[model samples]
Target: MNADGMRGGGRTLAAVDPAPEPPRVGPGAVLRQWFHGEHGVAPIVVGLVLVWVVLAAIAPDFLSAENLVNLTLQSVPVGVIALGVVLVLLVGQIDLSVGSVSGLAAAIVAVGTVTAGWPFALGVLVALACGMAVGLVYGVLSTRLGLPSFVITLAGLLFFAGVQLRVLGPLGSINLPFESWFVRAVQQGFLDPRVAWVLVAVWVLAYLGTQIWARERRRRAELSCVPWSQVVLRTGALALVLSATVGYLSTARGVGYSVVLFVVLVIIADVALRRTRWGRSVRAVGSDRRAALLSGVAVHRTVVSCFVACTTLAALGGILAAGRLGAANQGTGGADTYLTAIAAAVIGGTSLFGGRGSAWSALLGVLVIQSVANGLTLLDLDQATRFMVTGAVLLGAIIVDMLVRRRRQEA
Candidate 1:
């Protein structure tokens, strides 16, 4: 097979046969393919739209610019954690201890700065280093000692929770100074209106440039390239959506710096997964570890990198959460937090069976989850109702994933 064909076929072998080549046709056909293609985010986008419509009908203010802005901010911490979950899931591993790690980071930073007299930046760095250490240990256990990830993380989860409690001691909670830059940036920092617009423009332009560059490279290599018209169409649609969102948010506090950071992380992850050799090795390992080994991929190193990345991101997410909330407590990154992160990753369309997903899944999935939680809160629904509804949604996503996998295999 040609290199492109090999790459395409190698994307998902854990649960399904290789997908057949898509028919070469016109732009219209490609557009259709974009929507209905397996593993695309289009379905989740549609689901989010439906969710918004339903919630708006029930509570007219749910879509108000102010609430939407708040929603964006509220989604950031879990969204960041979910992004890490996507990486772990893509590599056919699980990290159930993310919540504990995040909570521990928050505790360390809180105590370090508030009690131990450490500088804020130093505290943050220490916390993140701890997270990386956790991941490194987990990776070694899984790769070297041959322990299953599920068990390793499960044990880590309990152990880290104990560590967090010990760090906090009898205080039970520690609050950061509200005026600290870390807290202010997460809680009160909004992009200037002009800057927001400029960011939108830059993103749109970068997207367009990327598409054109890719097409040119493919053409030069004698590979099939997407037509220019289709490229322009996608760019236009993205520009319109981003422009409209910024305009709406501009009416309120505009985009929060925390939101911007989360998005930048997502964009970086998407690019890495799509364009880097490390990413290719990750997918290859997830698709078939033995085959990837035979093909000369450094399977252990790749898995270790992913685990380290996952915990590091989780730590960062915890830092953001602490900043946003202005405190760290035993309940900071509780069971609900990690569960929500995992559910969001899956709901955003990352396959649990592995090797088929996207970085954007983290954003879309968290949006769905946070939107639901926000809408329910607005309606004064009880926590029980929110849990039931979110659980149902998660179950439905898993079912859909299995059905899609089965269909691909049959095809």
Candidate 2:
């Protein structure tokens, strides 16, 4: 194959196939292809870097301290929602109910604490647990009952909304005290700018170290050892952006509490789906249920777990929404959070067909979607215009994915 063909083929092969031998390609091209193959996040990262540069040039205030912190806060919640979507996408399913579940969770938290006088901590836990429980139920229905996740979670979207209305009853709005530690932590920035950089360092070190350790273990087991240079280059590339971005944002107003929570959620989720035995089975079942069954993977269990994980995360997003909104109302999740969540996942590079995605992709996707949304809204554009633009972006993502898929088959 020619180098361009090899480059096109290398990406999809990364997740599902072994690293192939190089064809006729220059050393520089080989390195570029390898980097793109292993880290699907790189393209999105470049896009983000470009965005920062353009936005800063166009609107000097775009990189100002206040705006930077707000951007982090905004990015964080979407990142959280995307994490849940990633799990479902990995398992070859889609949950349309996440946006609704998010609304439901926020309504419950607001109603339980603000209206019903429940403790803030207990209310938050209950909201989150309930969201997770609802997800688990959907998983059972989809896996045990053999209903499609599309239909199941779609029903869940409505079901959860009704639950939200019932909880909010009569008075659709209530006040939540901002003094509580949990509330403050979820809403306000912690770890001022300097500490935010330190936290980012910890995240980079821990993530790379864990992956390197895994590569070493594989080498010991006679599995392919991803080259040391490959690991180093990828890690360094990631560190450059992460360190710079975190430093820039922290200097503005320190890292937003929501962004930190978002990062933590993504890490937990990525680990759960990619690092665990259950995570393996989830991917296996999604890629091919029959093959998974033949290989002794619990196809049913994996499917159910994937659904449960997705819904629970959806619920968590709803709670985060409540924090951002400062109340639960008819309008809280009414902004099509569910659709956006799906769009964010799909556009962030999650496969619509199943068995290919990453949690980090969700974060990146959300950033893209929200950046566009926010940028448009700032120009005083109408809702119709925004929706039309969003539709185009979503369509573009699907096209890229299909093109990538076709190229993979050809290879």
My TM-score estimates for the predictions, one after another, are 0.93, 0.87
Off by over 4 Å in 2: 1-39, 47-60, 211-224
lDDT per residue for candidate 1 within 162-248, as digits (tens), equals: 999999999899999998999999999999999999999999998888778877887787676766777777788889989989999
Question: Could you tell me how far off, in angstroms, the CA of residue 411 lies in candidate 1 after the best superposition?
Answer: 5.0
| lDDT values for all models | 0.87, 0.72
- Candidate 1 has a TM-score of 0.93
Index of the highest-TM-score prediction: 1
Tens digit of lDDT per residue, candidate 2, span 189-298?
A: 46676677778788789768866887778767765455566566667866987887777766656777777778777777767766689877877777887899999998
Kindly give the number of clashing pairs for every candidate: 0, 3
Candidate 2, number of clashes: 3
